[model samples]
Target: MQRRLIASVLLGHYLSAFTALGIPLYLPRILADLAPDAPLWSIGVLFVLPTLCTALAAPLWGRLADRHGCRLSLLRAHLGLCAGFLLAGFSPNLALFVLALVIQGTFGGAMAASNAYLATQLDKDGLARALNWTQYSARLAMISGPILLGLLTAQGLGLELYRWLAPLPLLAFALVLPLPADRPRRPARAAGSATTNIRLPGDLQRLLAVQFLFSFAMVVTFPYFVPYGEGLGIANDALLGLLYSLPHGVYLLALPWAQRRAANPLGVGLALLALGNALQFAIVQPEPLLALRLLSGAGMLLAFVGLHRCLSQRSRQGGAGRLFGWYDASGKWAGTVAGVSAGLLSQGYGIASPFLVACVAACAALLLARPLVACPRELPA
Candidate 1:
């Protein structure tokens, strides 16, 4: 029973990670196919809008997890994702594509729901392990999603297939819902539908800020890397996907180790995230190289794993659902901004610039993370 619960949580998080990365992985092909006529700015907007929707919807989903339960909420969110991404495959215009993305974005709470479920079940040590597993799942998805999408697209599937692919993960996710609802006295009140009942604490404002800064620094790389690779003579499609997946592949392998050692997970994540960027900076030659990016990916995984562990620790209160919603919201918003900014900048300066900016952003986050380091909760008291 315990092992099943852990598997469900891990698989659920992996599925959500697959959903979250779909756009960035497929966006270029999507724009070329569906919105070829749209301006670069408009394409960027289509990218940002869904993330914006996720940012808005995460809080609601988080609360829904609190009032009802995370498992059911996970099922509901997956249903939303199935519908949204399916529509995206058949979307004929930028507007409809944007609509599908918003739908996907709104359902992005699958991760939050999974987290809330784990938070409720796991004690501190358990929560830490569960979240470490969650990080591993994300790295696996990041590696797998692109490779899978690339393969599917290779068979003339193009990018629209995400529409169909999106539904299956959630459908699989729904299979695990039984564990959380052992008693099954579900709320039927309309007011309790998707909105959260738990309130976020005002005192944790600084924590949220640190979370936001960390995500902001890291998210800037999403939309720009593929295009950057293409520009730098990465002509083989398989190689391109490999280049993108390598860093995450390395990260996935190391997550368990990091979870064991970090005393202050968030602070450690922030500092390492900054250092990861610096490593990227160190590789900032005149062009983008796949090998260097792989190294960067390893650094990113370490940093992001730390960040997630910190947030898991922070979300241990009764308002955990609310906390997760806000945490996810910040990451979504930060990614949206970074994706758009990278898109615009890529229209001119090329790929090295976005990563360079990532380095700077990480430094800023490190400065903010100092307080978290100094005042960690689980100190040797």
Candidate 2:
């Protein structure tokens, strides 16, 4: 029954992500159609707006879930996402569209809510495993979302598909209805089971910091990645799409192995990420760039697995809804800042400049993560 619930959550996560992921990619085009005279920076602002709002709103939602139930929170996210997408689809002007995005970000925190819901059903190790599966579902969505969207776009359905994606999350909502409700567990039960007795505030702060830096570094390079690739001389759309999906592919293939084998996955992952980003800035040739991209992907797998392990352990102590809420907020805030910074850096310096910034952030994250591994209670070998 637990496995079935996990499977349902994974499926819901993938479907929602697969349908909604294309919006960011298609934003510029969507903006062009809606407001041809809009400034370039507005596109960036709009792109980041939802994330910014989500960061601000997630904690409140988390508290709500803690007070109510995670199952209810999960249902709310799916319905909220559906409403937000519908609003965006029907908006007649830019102002209304911006409002739609605000609604979307403010209420569409399904990932965090889902993680919190899962925390109710699993132990530390089992929660870690479930988180991995959730990440895999997201990675799979990233791999397939664009391809499917591209096919539909090519079919002359065009922008209408954006509106149509609004209903996908409802399928996820229905899936959640049959799952058992989340009941609160006693603190003693969690304390008795946990392998580590983590001290709060300090440990939690470090985790939040790691999450922030990890997100900032990864997302900082995303906005202008296509332009950077084009600068490297890859012109074919199909090939470019393949190259773009490489890191996600690497995650799909390598994360499970990394989770099992790496003794200090977070430390090693941060090191690889720093190296990959730094080297990427120096290398101009397509082949070497591809290699570095693969290296970065490897780093992503280890780093994400390590982080999820820590998160799972922490979430076990009850009030998981609130904990995961803050956790997701940190990452969302990082993404919001990263998106804005990428646009600025790309415009002022060059498309490749953000890679250097990402490298610096990764190095900072590496330094920050050292203490985490050194503290035996925080992470498993």
Candidate 3:
């Protein structure tokens, strides 16, 4: 029964991620098809607006998950996503498309709700394992979504196919109905209660800071990787696609190893993140750049899984949903900032300069992470 529940949750995560991310992967193509004369800045705005809305909405969804139930929250989120994607599929203009994204962001709490549910169902070790597996599923979706889009586009059915597939996540959420119902376990404290006003642990605050910095660093170079690669003289569309997916491939491969033997996982992950970004400076060729990206992917997966595990364990007292919500929001906010920064750095400095900024941010996150890992918090049994 537990295995089945886990499987269902994993499936839900994969489908949600696939649908949410897949369309955006084709944003450039979608815009070109819908509004051929749209400026490049429109792409950035399209991405940022949804993310901003999501960042704002995450906390409210988290609180609802905590007050109501994880299962219900997941259902609501998935349903909203289904409707949002359907609207986006039929959108006649960029304004309507942006509205669809806002709807998706406002109600799509699949990732946060899933994490909260798993945190409740499993012990610390089991939670870590589940989180890693879910991360793997998400990474797989990231890799496969783009490929699926490419194949469909090749058949000249890209936009139409995306519209048709928009509600696929709704089918995935149907599987969630068979899983055990998640009732709210934590009763709300009365207003002005001592516990209600209590602050987050200092270590948790530092951990969130690390999350923000790492997210910013990762996004700083993410939107420009293809352009940077092109600047490095790799012009083949297929090769560029391969380069784009290589990090996720490396992350999938490295997950098991990191899960098994990552004793100082947070510290080690941070160090690897810093190292990977630093290595980008020396890679002037495509071959070496590929290797650098792979290494960076491994580092990213390790750090993210490790930190999420740490946060889950620490917040297990009943605020898991809220904590994970904040976690998601911080990353989204950082990504928003990073997107703008990446553009400015790319424009003013050079295409590759954002990587230098990313390297610095990674290093800063490493420093912030050290104190938290040194004094690890204990989880309740």
Using lDDT as the measure, which candidate wins?
A: 2
- The residue ranges of model 2 lying beyond 4 angstroms of the native Cα positions read 184-202, 376-381
In the range 68-143, model 2's lDDT, one tens digit per residue, is: 7888899898888888888888888889999989988898888898898998778888888888888898889877
Could you tell me the lDDT of residue 71 within candidate 1?
66
Candidate 3: worst-modelled 10 consecutive residues by lDDT: 194-203
The 10-residue segment of model 1 with minimum total lDDT is 181-190
Tell me the whole-model lDDT of each prediction, alpha carbons only: 0.66, 0.82, 0.78
lDDT of 2: 0.82
| lDDT, candidate 3, at 232 | 85
For model 3, name the residue pairs that clash: none
- Tens-digit lDDT track of model 3 for 267-331: 67767767777778557776787777787887888787778667755767366677777888888
**CA RMSD for every model?**
5.1, 4.0, 2.3
Q: How accurate is candidate 3 locally (lDDT)?
A: 0.78
Model 1: which residue pairs collide?
63-196, 85-163
Query: Can you write out model 1's per-residue Cα lDDT over 124-226, one digit (the tens) per residue?
Result: 6677677667667766776777767777778777655776577666665676666756222233345647734343544366666766666766667765666
